[model samples]
Target: MRTNTFLFTVLVISIPYSLSADSFTFFNYYHDHMVLQKSSTGTTIWGQSSKVNDVVHIQIDNKEVAQTTVSSHHIWEAKFTSPSDNTPHTVSAVSSLGTIHISDVLFGDVWVCSGQSNMEFNLHGVLNATAEFADSANYPNIRFLHVHRQYSASPLTDIDSVDAVWNTPSEKSLSSFSAVCWLYGKYLSQHFNYPIGLVETNWGGTRIEAWSSPDAVRRCAAFGRKRNQYSQSQLYNAMIYPLLRNTIKGVIWYQGESNAAHAYKYSCQFLEMIMDWRTKFNTASLGTTSSSFPFGFVQLAPWREGEANLGFPQLRWSQTSNIGYVPNGLMQNVFMAVAMDLPDFQSPYGNIHPRYKHEVAYRLYLGALGVAYHETDVDFEGPFPTSARIDKSTSILTVEYDRGLHPIEVRSYNGFEVCCVNQTTTFCNAFDSHWINVTMTSHSFASISLDVSSCSHGNHVTQVRYAWRESPCAFKQCAVYGKMNNLPGPPFTYYVH
Candidate 1:
């Protein structure tokens, strides 16, 4: 009887502790020792732990940052400033009562990589993924924090997937890396060797509104009141809100499929969202702005009419137009290895997924070279037209771009036809005729000169549009690297400078 009672009593006490160790109870284990990593060199983190005899040991980079005892309420807290460089650090608290360790601790540039299906597409789906994942091995220095998908009006402090490890690439877990982000990190890691952290937070079918906060959407001029429907900040509540105060390099965004039909709104409104994100991120004493955060991203890849969206085509054009509004350093850079010669642009036109994610990563690498690493000679952008001159009597149109490789091929995509401002063009108009052509054939000049004797005049002599009608994405003059072909140029709106 004595033996039976003694055994029963021990079970009563041990059960709670064991369950706490293995289960998700009593404040998410993730939240219990919630880590606040790299706020600002000027800021500090403070929190409370609820337990008795708890010996709280605060750690950074796997070493002790601070330590203390739990109060009567069994709670404790700590504070830290931003890290010195792009180095990863771990933060946690282990009490006599329990233990907590957060994975993929990083101190360097941390960016939230988000988007829809393409953004959600993982490393495993990309070509050479098996080899890349295997060869890259585990990157203990490059950490990744993935937020689980959840819908909620109020923000959540403790999310579903915690203790997320920033392990190196491998066949088993590499599939989780957003192909774009993984490749981006590989390029940055190889060049900088600074700790790189990726916060993977994206919903497969999410719209731009879904990823934004209610307040952010409300502020957008285009969303108007309708934005309220998906604008309650549900995503940030589940994703961004929970990871507040964690410093970041910038955001790599790859969305817009849901609202592609509304690219016009996206041009300005989307940049507004970028402003919002930067405002939120920069809100910290950390004070990092999107303008300065190195927010570079992919301009969507080339896709044929049938595969993904049937026959619609304005979406891609809208994205190209928006690039003009995106801040200089933070935009769709075309000069790099992004879409140059991607498989999607080639023969197998049916596959919607561009499995060669490495190319996307390659583009990002170019962006980092120019942005984060501060390399000036990097070429990851496209030509910006600075001025234009129209000579009606001479039948010549001279156009100058802000930047270019020069002697670039000019044409209407799918053989863009030239027509007069009065009459619509015929099939013959689509092909280059006596009216439209390229001139001044040297690569050294910054501007391309074309003779338009055969082309149509626009609303006035003051304005002469080139290929003003709908056009395809095909351009023969892509850079030698060819990443710029995915997005065809928009019908240019020229003004004399």
Candidate 2:
């Protein structure tokens, strides 16, 4: 006979932990201290059962709510109206063979946060990490489910592994959790005074195509038949497919560096993926039918040095479908966090990953409050050009801005550029462009005046752009910003119109 001894260190004090998956067990996402979406359309509970044709009863607070028979595939599912209240409740699933119980279950808004390394940047990597970790225990209602990274050629019905169970925020659990997801959930918890669930499903060094489905990629005309077979749709098969049956509030994404080389096609591919996700999520048996759910993302952060002509600026433009802002003509029900000013050249991880995740998450929360929750009091976006024109009489280009709830602050007029049209060709090119000086308007307070006297060479200036470079300015020192919110103006290039 052989004997084995084991020692365990318990970090979660409230959860009644269980690691065994038996004849009747819920999916990996449902467990103690888990949160289900509080939807009027109802919520679905599913699990695997060995006994086919056997009935399984689902109860809340020991009161029977719904029941279903086990299918031939050894699976059982039951749907019921989820409670809107955020208070904890006890849930149990009973069968002829056994009974499975999960305590501390809460009904609340659940968000899926997905992307590449930037979204995978953990809490320990952010600034003031120790202080943040110490204060994490204060928000007990904010929960997290960190999905283990995986890739598959085909869709998965269930997750292969879980990095951590549905866990309440703590130093131990948050050390490796997504920083952007945690901070955004913390903001929501404080504002709504309720439970908030965040699902972290992301991988490092992955392109947008890998996160998108094959059907979505094929819909993109730019990638119709030229898509690479190695990594295309692999991450989505394993990571996102298994969660299609789960209802979610929205999604927050932070990716794009890996696809910078093919930045020109990003607009087509990204938009198609968003539409595909909305359509699929609406049609799924257990997912929500709200097809226009809010989607938010972080724009690429500045990188000091990398491949030449890597198209970071172009990729940033492509992120917005070349519109320079979300909720535009190209995309709706979407928002973005401008990260052009956050350049972290000394980060231990790499120059591409910035350490200012707290600010990014805060901005994302503001967008959620406005776009998702439909709160009109908060300004979710930074300053942007509402209109522009060149004063031929004064040789000045006055750009009017729609500063959302804040006044424009011009720290330095560094990134203003004017396209001087060539005399012979009657067309403007980058070679003919030159840096221009700009000043704050004393009268409007939301507008800037640029000196375009030097741009006249038998042809007047035809275009203008700002912060159109890999590293636009020093860290947090962009030329334009929102004075109160401290949000940098998004990078843009547009003709004078």
Candidate 3:
């Protein structure tokens, strides 16, 4: 393998041993065109060696940097500082057994894009697939490694296999890959002008517990353990555990559809899972000692269902731990992309899977730019309600919002609803609530005034909410939006004060 010209090569003689090319090889995840996490202290490199006690040497551009002895289990790992330059370098691993080499490796940020079916949704299913595939060649530095779907009852040291190697963006490679993963990376590449790597590991119709560690799931009081093969902790064992050795910038998840039945429990379960992942990845990955890695996720999108118990709205709220927006007290260094306004009622795949993934990916990229990259100038958050108060004398309910890059644009108040309580309770049940007419009286942009005289409970109204149904309004027609960005105000339920 070629060595970097800036680095000096160190020569060492090795005695021949009873080992073949297959006996000494890098892990399946390490391959040509891969982007290693750029770290000044250390970047981890691992492989399997056939002979125990034998030393495995790792080299970047032919210069030996770190070495480690093969364990009794035949696993070996080495840590060395990876170069921060953008130029491609060759990586080589040498041992008494044999030498393995891969070409065209780069140092850059790597992100894990994971979750359920929505995350697994391929670019082929998107509406702009044709144009996207044609323009893929423009993003040669944006690459992906698609992990093959698998689940195990116990944690695995390495994955069994992958659907694809570290592949650069191409018409063929981009077509069948995860749409959100590719689009997000593409944006990063454009912004930073550096190599961007994305690891797409997700499965369709999988629950949060399936992807969460056993300890994480146990922390949720409402969650119960199951011994089934495809149950709790199975996906985390097979999918997430194997990638712990590699340092990642952060993660962007798209899920929660499968957890709708237990939406209330998600407020606790989701935070537990994020904390668990941060702990494990920080401890296992070399040079990543920080436990507060940036995490971004997509809130559940609206669907054409009338059943109040379906729990899509509740799931979205719980996604934020009932706080509405992220980076709150419950979740730090985290962000969300609200999708309630982007409903897909007639997708070819199904109503649940939206075809407008470009918007979702754009929003996710915006979050990454703001939270992960620390681009303070970028505004990604949608308009969020800060407070809601009712003026019984004026018969108007004024809701104040925290604005982002633009002021609030009150469209039609289609999703606004008021709750009249006959008895005191924690939250007004969705089934017991009814819709009321709301008209914009004042021309205020930051704070909106709604005429709520039509509310049956009148002064007895206890709560106010917007877009609180499986399908609250037509696609992209939610009541409130940003004046310029068109980012809809997120779905929220606030107590009247």
Candidate 4:
């Protein structure tokens, strides 16, 4: 009697195990309440099934869309036309094992919010967390998929588990969602009146090398030790590669604090990273017309005071220069969200994480409005110094800017600093005396008159730096802004000829 009972128990346990092994299931991202990329031509759905070579049927809104067979590797994929209209529809996948139904899937714009700690910063950690969390229930169409942090030495086919699945924003989820991404999606959803999908992938204190492919980093000679020391392509393999097949509108990056030490090499490293992502994700589903997609990023906020060794300024310059230095054939779609004025002034000497994430989000939204959406009327950037000319007669440097810039509001002329190029030493030295004065000539112009007589190197001012300190706000009270939009002028240094 005991032997017979043991045999029956073994059979019962083996039956369910065999049945489950034969079943098919969708990728983790294809769960219910997901949002498909509406702007793309089609949406690609992929899954795995135990029954290889079996036919798989796909349907959207009960209409047959595609039919394909599972591959020898037990993997299957189907592409379905996504309607331009942002309406919710039911998606289903049927195989020999069974039929899986996904409910409440919408077609809309999808954006990937990625970076380090700032991008990973949650809504509950920002200012006015309670009010924002309570108000999040109003936007039911905004969905979020928070990709769990993971790393691997080799590329991964899929993540082991996802922290958060696709769901409409609620008080519970909003509190933990990325604050900048949440606010950005909220603004876009209100303006476009469509569902917005955000994929949050980030790791705190991670350098740019961690997010880039190993081969790409190895190609750049400047990243010598970085290529071998860190786990090459670990984050890219585990976090990004799995989602390359998914269609996305663009990416919003908010990193660089960790890469500040390697600021000189950032321009090449960052550009390579951008091109790498564009090349990998440029499939039919994600769109292939353009070699690159729109990429917007936040400039590092102010940090420690007078720490030039930190390379914050150098990193900021590299970020801005990348807007114009796109790889050949790739579209010039890079944009920057300046954060010079967004840092917390109370603890400018210590605080690196600014509490005012809403402003940062708004700035990123403005950049997307102009660069991605192509809104001509939107003034997305502050007054940028376009060209500078030095008048030998009067020793005055006049800097020209783009249109729509208002007069620079100067609390004090302290941010302006002059560096004299020493012919004998071949080095530029800061002027010892008060050798510069700034004057707002017009609504869109400014002139800095150098005191050539007071300069130590006779009239040879090699460079002029404006608000270029590590913490200009804290030390020099650097206050310059666009009168029209009230946006602060980005910190910059100019070479005088």
Who wins the TM-score comparison?
3
What lDDT would candidate 1 get against the real structure? 0.50
Local distance difference test, each candidate: 0.50, 0.79, 0.79, 0.70
> Which residue pairs collide, candidate 3?
3-61
RMSD (Cα, Å) for all candidates, in order, is 11.8, 9.3, 7.2, 10.3
Question: Residue 321, candidate 2: how far off, in angstroms?
Answer: 1.5
Write one digit per residue (lDDT tens) for candidate 1, span 1-497: 01111111010011112223322122232321122234444333333454544567766556776666654543344444545764334555566555566544445666678776777788777767667777766455665656667655665544546434444456665667678877787777787776666777777756677666555666554442332324546676666654553456667777665675565556555555655565555553134333245566555554552243411233433444423323344343222233422435442323445676776777667766766556877665445456667676776656666554333443322212222343343222222232232333222336555555555444222332332222223323332111242332233334432
The sequence of per-residue lDDT tens digits that candidate 3 reaches over residues 1-497 is 21111111111112223445458878878989998887655788887777889988888898998889997767787888878789999999898877899899988888899998888899999997889988889877777899988887777778768999899887788766899888888888888999888999999888888888877877776453675434798888888888877888889999998888888899988988888788877767754534678999999987775545548888888999888888788788898888887778789889989988989989888888888878888877878878889888877898888883244444565667787655554457655644444666764667777777876552366778878888776777777777556777788888878
Location of the lowest summed lDDT over 10 successive residues in candidate 4: 4-13
Q: lDDT tens digits, residues 392-458, model 2?
A: 9888788777784235445666777777665554345333434353443332457777877876657
Root mean square deviation (Cα) for candidate 2:
9.3
Error of 3 at 234 (Å): 0.9
Q: In model 2, which runs have C-alpha deviations exceeding 4 angstroms?
A: 1-22, 221-230, 285-289, 305-310, 404-409, 423-444
Residue-level lDDT for 286 in candidate 4: 37
**Candidate order, lDDT descending:** 3, 2, 4, 1
Question: Alpha carbon lDDT of residue 415, candidate 3?
Answer: 69
Estimate the lDDT of model 4.
0.70
Count of backbone clashes for each model? Answer: 31, 0, 1, 0
